[model samples]
Target: MSRYLFALGQLVARRRWWVLAVWIVLLVGAICFAAGTGGKTNDNFTVPGTESQDAVSLLQQRMPTFSGAQMQVVFATPGLAKVTDQQVRAEIEQTMAGLQGLPQVAQVVDPFQAQAVSPDQRVALGTVQFSVSAGEVDADTLDGVDRIAGPAREAGLEVQFSGAVYPGFTADIPHTPEILGIVAAFVILLITFGAVVAAGLPIVTALVGVGIGLTGILGVAAFVDVPSAATSLALMLGLSCGIDYALFILSRHRHNIVLGMPAAESIPLAVGTAGSSVVFAAVTVIIALCGLTVAGIPFLTVMGLTAAGAVLVAMLVALTLLPALLGFAGDTVAKFISPPLHPGKAEEVARIAAYEPERTCGHAWGRFVTRFRIPLLVLGIAILAVVAIPATRMDLGLPSGATQAESSTARKAYDLVSRSFGPGFNGPLLVVTDLSHATGADAAQTLMGRLRQESNVAAVQPGGSGNGMLLIQVFPKTGPNDSATTDLVNRLRDDRDRIESGTGATYLVGGTTAANIDTSNRLAAALPVFLAVVVGLALLLLTIAFRTVLVPLSSIVGFMLSVFAALGAQVAVFQWGWGASLFHVAKAQTLSFLPIITLAIIFGLSSDYQIFVVSRIKEEHTRTADAIASVQNGVAHSARVVTAAALIMFGVFVAFTAVDNPIVKPLAFTLAVGVLFDAFIVRLTLVPAVMALIGNRMWYHPRWFARYIPDLDIEGAELERRFAHDAEVEVPQGITGVS
Candidate 1:
């Protein structure tokens, strides 16, 4: 793999202009294709094979009107007032009249007639049934509902629309988050490289790669059922990995230039070594992402595969485009605001661009850490364990209106309903029963009686009946994300066989609330299987890549610490509401996919940091034959670049915490902190301490395993071997060069 990369890098250097042109043309074509035939993204929440899905299918077949996108147009006033008063009722009825006339509105039920008014009569909830799903509702149609409600607003009633229809969903997601993240990344890169050209090159390459990937996603979304969130995930991963991958390789090439290696030699050497690590790291990430399918969840499968595709593109860009760009950059990437690294010294160039170590700050830290290896190891584990304690109480469930931003319209409606009706009014479970063999009234009464016996049941009322199918609506005493509601759902299902056997009726517990419960239960059941497939598979792959058992074992342990630490932070902040006021966020159930997604991505990053740092140390250990010097020299050389890349990735992810989207905020926070702990504490601190304890035995591998484990040659050993015999020369210690 390294030899192929070396040859590819040399080829790119020889054809730099052609390579640049091809990338430019490809990028342009992608832009044009997306603009010409771009498609909108829709969020698909349906979990196949669940009771909720079966109920929806039943509704679509028998009771079509009630099956479509349903929401409440809530009108609220102070407790002293009643919306049913003559004047308020008149205005609200007029507004409903206008809503009925709007496009895609199938029907509008009047609050007074439906008896949907609250006990205090201060809040009135009217139903608006749409002809199509929420995703198909035009933005103009949703806006028209708001626009036509002027009469109700004028009558002193606070009118609000509910459901996904209110958001007026659009494909034009705001670019502010991406722009902010990129700005932060550029600042960190400038500090790391200390040159405008050097810093800007990584940023440019990252933007180019992300631009192409994003456009391709948009273009393909026209023909594919791509979810809106998938694009965000793709953009985030693509940009973060692209910048870090390019930065690592460029950092290597910059040092080579400083040592007076020619551009031709330095470029290939950088690609052969650093680029190989990038590929291995990306493969691990892609594998973990693809493993999401093992959960047997469709939407999650889409998200994982989509994110993995972006990571793959970023890796390829770093390997191919970055090298070609470096060929043109030469010393310009390393020589700005200071003397150039190489001052035109081609006369006495050495054939083998050997590994040179300097006594830098990383070297000093490595020596100190290894000397106190036991204490450092204990301290790192103690910090992680302490942080992970919060994860024990973490709540994992779907987001509810109660967890929405306080100022959001969804929260307003939820609060108004809860204040007037009850908290459970925001989440009502629907029971759909088949009354084919028995009388409709008898079957409906029997099912409602069974539901009424449930401990958490607040109210059980007939929803509607049509075509031998009866709908029963049951409201819980607790909120949608409450554990009590989950228990009620389980109890209902447990009694399903007894209830149906006695009445000749078949039923399904469904609706948004019940569906969320079912989805959560499914995810809980699958989490273990997901971890086994993704983590177990990643371990085996790492074993093959490194040809060592202890290293991969250490990596998995570090991975757990990083991911759990991040989840603990999320639980404390988002779930426990600790420091919530700072972000203007509310306490709620953490996003259900947060842990799963975080684990998969972090597993990849852990592998990346482990391989990049350890492989360098292993290279020096092989060359020097002294474990202590190998640790010191390798740390001196690789630590700076590793630290810089970690920080850049951290900056990119951290910037998304400020986004208004609730789903993105927790995930961004998790990834940001996960990267920080994994890179700084796990990679830099724990890894070296363990290696110190193991001594030279850290590199040991059984002969049987060694024969099967193909050498990736990520250390550039093959490149050096080929060059050394051709023309080896010793580089004097004091030799220096400048552009």
Candidate 2:
């Protein structure tokens, strides 16, 4: 592995311009191809083989008019008893006619014709049907509807649109968050390196890598059904990982140069050493992300693949592009853009001191922790447990319109409809029945009566029938995200035998709400499997790399603790409504996919830090044959790099919270918190303390098994072996061997 990395680095460094030019060409071509394709991304969460999906399929097949892309244009005339005035009625009718005339409109149901006007007469809903599915509707059709609603708005009436596709139409890729994240990362790097040129290298490398990855993702969308949120997720992961990967290699190169190695020797040495860890870390992340396929969710599968591709690209760029750039810059790269503080010039001098591989904050802190290992370990565990308590009450569901920004047209429409009609109006359930074997009309009538009589049922209306199936719309009294609605769905499905007794009819309760419930349930069932697979794979990889049992076990356990703590924080803010307003959350419900997705990403990222830190400790142990000194020195050596990397990632993740999209915001917050907890509490505190207490046992492994497992040497022990003999020959004048 070291040889290969060394060869690759030397090749890129020698052909730096050619390498850089090739990347530029690929990036440009990718951008052009993506723009030309201009493919659409959808957030459809249909779970194949689920009852809700089956119902949707049946409806689309048999009752096409009722099943196609549907949106509601809500109208409210405040201060008027009802919208019954002749002029208002004429205007609404004309608007309906105009909507129906659009080429995309399959049909438009007028409020007057459908008798959908509220009993109070202050509000009315006009349903528009599009020829394609909600996700398939083009922007032009949505724009046409918006234009048709203009006259009503101008006539002193409130008009708003709300539907599955309505939010998508208004959603914008949040550029503000990405920009702020990059800026924050730059500031962090500047502080860490104390030089503009040194700081900019990581940021520049990361942006280039993420740019290519995101563009490639767009091309992938042209052929596959990628979720709209996938790009944002890719960006978040790509930027952080790209910067961190480059930072690791760049830092190592600088340290080597400070030790008197020339640019030619230092570049390959840095690449061969830190680059191996980057590869290992990247592979772990890719494995954990790709494991999403076991969940059997199409969106998750595609999302995972997209994110993995981005991480892979970032790793490649860090290994190739960063080295080439370093080579091109040569000795000038070591010079700080900002001059270092004068010697003995107060605390600032301590902060801006030149790189010293022998001494680090970690070394001092490791010794302190070792002296009070038990107390520190206990304290760390207690803190994590306290923070993780909120996870116990997590309630997962898709964000409904109520959670949308109040200023959004969709939210305004939802509020108006809920106030005038009912919360149930926002998400009506479609109960479809195959009545071929029963007295069709009578069975339908019986089912409708039964549904209307149920306590939770707000309204039961005939939803048209075709062929051998009967469709009935059942509106629950509660909103879609309400627990009562989920209960109603479960009750209807579970009690089908009692409800349809002697009717010989099959009933399926489905809608946007039911689909959400199904998706949540399916993911919940798959969670255990997903966790087991991810953990098993990570344990195997760690065991092979470290040649130890307790080390891998400890790493996995620490990862879980960090994940739980992060989740608890998320649930407290988003679900419990604590600090919800701070994050712009209008309502408190955990996004259904948040926990699972965060867990996968956090696990992978946490493993990266774990491997880098532990690999260093193991290397020190092997070289010195002193467990205690090795643990302390190793941590001291790796602490600064790990903390800086963590801060960079934390900033990127936090910036994503600025995005208005509910789905992206909570995910970002959780990931940010997870990184912080893992870095400071788990890796920096708990890990070293626990390893100190365990001493040599931390590296214990069965001799037979150790022989079978290949040494990963992620810290580049092999590279050091090849280069140690050349150190004296390569050392510049005035630089002597250590001590």
Candidate 3:
């Protein structure tokens, strides 16, 4: 792997202009193709094989009119004695008239006819129904609806929209988060690299990679139902991972340059060594992402694959495009646009000081940790354990309107509907009962009476009955994402057998609220399977790389601590509402899939830290045969790049929280906190402390065991063996060796 990467890097550097042109053309072509034929992203939030989906399917087959997507158009004003002003009523009636003219409209239910006007006369709910599925409803239909609402808005009434078909956010990439993240990356990189071009190169390569990845997803959206969150996740992972990969290689190249190696020579050498580690890191992430299929959710599967594709592109950019750009810069890759901090020192000395951290802070910290290894290890564990306490009481659910920005229409509409009708009105349940075999004169009505008697049931209305199937709309007293609602759903299902025995009829609970319940249950069940399959397999794979049992075991332990700590932080801040105002979370609950996704993503990234840090120690230990000193030297060798990469990734993830997106915000926050704990505390503090305590026993892979596990040459040990005699250029043999 190292030899091939070395040759490939040399080829790319030699043909720098061609390599640059190819990437430019690919990015431009993707953008052009997406512009002409891109597909719109829509959320088809359903879990296949769930009872709720089955009920929906049965409804579509039997009752086509009501089964189609329905939009709730809310009209509100300051409390009025008349309930609704005559002019406001006139405006709403006009909008309904315009909606009737749309060719696809099946029916428009009038608010006055349905008596949907609140008792206060300040709020009204009207439904615009269509025959197509929510995912099939085009933007043209939505736009037409929005346009008709203009008159109502102009009539001193607030008009807001919320329903299955309405988009939660615009298609435009979240500019605030992405832009802020890039700016933060520039600052971090500038400080880390101490050179303008060096910092900019990573940002440039990362954007190109992310641009192509996102465009590809956009183009694929033309064919499939891509959730808007997929693009945001891809952007977050692609940009951060891209920069880190490039940083790893660039850091290596600078080290070589200061050590007397020519720029051209160092470029390939960097790729052969650091690029191998990048490939390892990227492959792990892709595998973990692809593992989302275990949950059997279509939207999440799309998200995982899209994110994996983006990561693959980022790795390729770091291996190929970054080297080409470095070739173009020539010796200037070693020069700083800003003056060196230690003026009057030799340029090499300043350059070395800027790029090679093992000499100063890295070594000093290494010594302190190793000297107090036991106490530091215990302290790290204690801190993470305390932070993880909130995770035990976590509450997971789908993001609701409450999770939205308070200023958004969806949020406003949600608030108005809850205040006017009831909190349960936002999440009404559709009960489908096959009452053909009714034992009594009115078994369906008897069942409805039973539902109304339940303490949680707020209202039970007739929802149309036909073909021996009775539909009942049951409204719970609690909000959609409330724990009380979840309990009520379970209680309702539990009483199904008893009701059927008395009525001689079968029934199911279905609707958006019910579907959310089913999805969360399904995700929770699959989480264990995912952990056993994906996490177990990942640990086994890491074992092959480390070629030891204890190192991999230690890594997994640290990963678990980091993940739980991060989750605990999320539960405290989001669920417990501790500092929730800072993030603008209108609701205090985490998303259902967030825990599993965080574990998968953080596990993959955790391996990167383990391999990068431990591989250096392994190399040093092999060369010097002194375990204690090797721990210090290895940490000193890799700490600078590891710290910079981790910080860059942490900042990028946090930047995504700047957007008002409900899905992206919490997901990014979890990832950012996970990275912070994993990188800074687990990898840097605990891993080293553990390694110092373990000593030589840490490298206990038997020679016989080495035969079964392939040596990936991730540290470029083979390259070192082959290039050891290159005295003129002072080629560093071991990737673990300090320049």
Candidate 4:
């Protein structure tokens, strides 16, 4: 496999010019098409395949008019006084009238009307009910809200509209991930490679890979419901790593060329070494992403499959298209681009950096590592341990649609209603009485009475006269995370038999909390599957790379620990209120998909760093019998590259946390922190420490396994044989190159 990769690298280098042209054209065309043709979907709650979703579906059938719409508007004066202005009333009436006339709107209540406002009159609230549509009513709702908001806000009144339209905010999120990711990738590359063209390689390669992935996803969404917005984040992340991985190898190859090696010899040498590492990294990522399949949320399942597909595509692009571009661009990429960035000695610097240093006093960096390896390791481990402590407090919950748009009109109105009425107004429980046995009001009343007695229940309204169901309002004593929410759910299920015994009907409980409970249950059931797939795949890759069982097994253990630490930090920030006030955010009802999504992302990215580091160490071990020397050489070589790359990747990932929406914020933030830990702690310190302990035993393969497996040229002697005798061995001087 390594020989074939090297040969492919050589072949591409020979015909680099044409391949580069083709890649550029294909990428440009794909980007243009994706801008218009690529479709989008939401990434929120999924049907749990539980009784809750079933109940919701059944209720929808019985009550076809049930539109998942809730709207709220608050009228607050500077002094919290009532608005008695006739103009305000007139404008409010006009907005309500406009909203009522919207195509799917079932009803719109005016706050000035008798039942809509509270008795005290300090606050006014309105509700807009919708008729269930065949598809999401986002477009119509957003349009109507915009029209209403325009005139409503123009009236010198503060009005907010939130509801179904809130999902549209996510619609634009997917479009700019690649763009944001590209900008981030470039800035990081500049810092790492210290050359503009060198930095451009990763950005360009990522653009090409992501463009193709986008087109592929657009093709797939036609057949399934791919409404998860996190797909954008996943794709961008995949592209960035994919292209950057190639950049790592290609940059190394260019260094060989500057050393006066022939293009044919240099390309293969680069591939025989770094290409093997890239493959290992790619496989680990694919395995980790596949882990999401165990999650079972259709949203998460699709994310798993699609994200894996994207990573696979990126790998192929990196191996083929990227090398071709690098080969064609040749010394010019590093040469012309490196000049202005570094004075006049760019080539000299590249040469000197490429020449593997033996042992040196070096500088402050070396002094610190040599003098304080133990203390630095201890300090790093302690910080990770502290962060991991928060995982004990982590609580997973699906984010409700109401929270999607914090500033949406409907959410604002809902908040107003909740503040003035009760917490139950923000989230209501749906009670479904089995119509087969009891079709009368008496059974409904009995169910309602039972629900009201539960601790979380603030009020139990017998399904209003229209829906012929029971509607219960649950007001948590403290907040959404209050034990009352969970207790209410348990109480309803616990009383199921008694509620139905005499009445001949069972009640199904469905609400935000109920849905959340179902989602949590589904994830728990699927977690084993996710872990099995991820670990199994990662082990397979490790076995293939090191030809040993222990190599992959150890890697998996370390990967899991790093991921747990990342999740723990997320719990502290989102669930524990560490950074909530920074952005005017509230403590989440529970940890959102951030942790799960972070798990998948961190798994893939961390695996990328691990592969690079381990592959380098393995390469060194094959060349020299001294295991300690191999460890020192590999760490010295790959640590800077991994750290610099991680810092750049961290910048991109961290930007997501700054988004206004709460869902992606934590997911992105956790991604940044997780990747940072993976690169610095796991890849650099923990991996080296463990490998040092294992020594040459880390590379031991059972004799029988070796006989069955075909040999690959990635074994160090092959690379040395190919490039060691090449006459172009003049090492350059000046700035150190990426190799």
- Summarize candidate 4's per-residue lDDT along 299-359 as a digit string, tens digits: 7778767877778877877787777777766665565344565564544445455564433
Give the Cα-based TM-score of candidate 3 against the true structure: 0.93
Writing each residue's lDDT as its tens digit, candidate 1 over 328-423 gives 877786564443574323211211122334435577778887899899999999998888889999778987778766777788888888887787
Q: Which pairs clash inside model 3?
A: 39-222, 83-121
**Error at 611, model 4, angstroms:** 1.5
Cα-based lDDT at residue 726, candidate 4:
41
- Tens-place lDDT digits, model 3, residues 1-739: 8899999899999999999999999999889878878577778776899888888788777777667666777888755534357777787788878887775677777788667888788888887777777777777877787787787777677888776655443535558888888898888887776678888999999999999998989888999888889999999999999999999999888877766678888899889988888898899889989999899998889999999999999999999999999998877766765455654233433344434545556777788889999899889999999999999998778877677788877788889999988888777788877777889877877898888988788888776677778778788888899889888888888878876677888888888788888989988998888878766866787787777888888988998999899999999888898898898886457788898888788988998888888888887787888888888888887887799899999999998887788788888999999999999899888998998898999888888889888877778877766655455443233222222
Clash count per candidate: 2, 1, 2, 25
Q: What is the Å distance of residue 3 in model 1 from its true position?
A: 0.4
Q: Is candidate 1 or candidate 2 better by lDDT?
A: 2
Give the local distance difference test score of model 3.
0.83
Structural RMSD, model 1: 3.7
Off by over 4 Å in 4: 15-18, 21-38, 67-97, 107-116, 133-135, 149-157, 164-171, 174-184, 336-348, 359-378, 400-411, 439-441, 462-481, 579-585, 708-717, 726-739
TM-score of each: 0.93, 0.95, 0.93, 0.88
Q: Extract clashing residue pairs from model 1.
A: 340-739, 343-738
In model 2, the clashing pairs are: 363-636
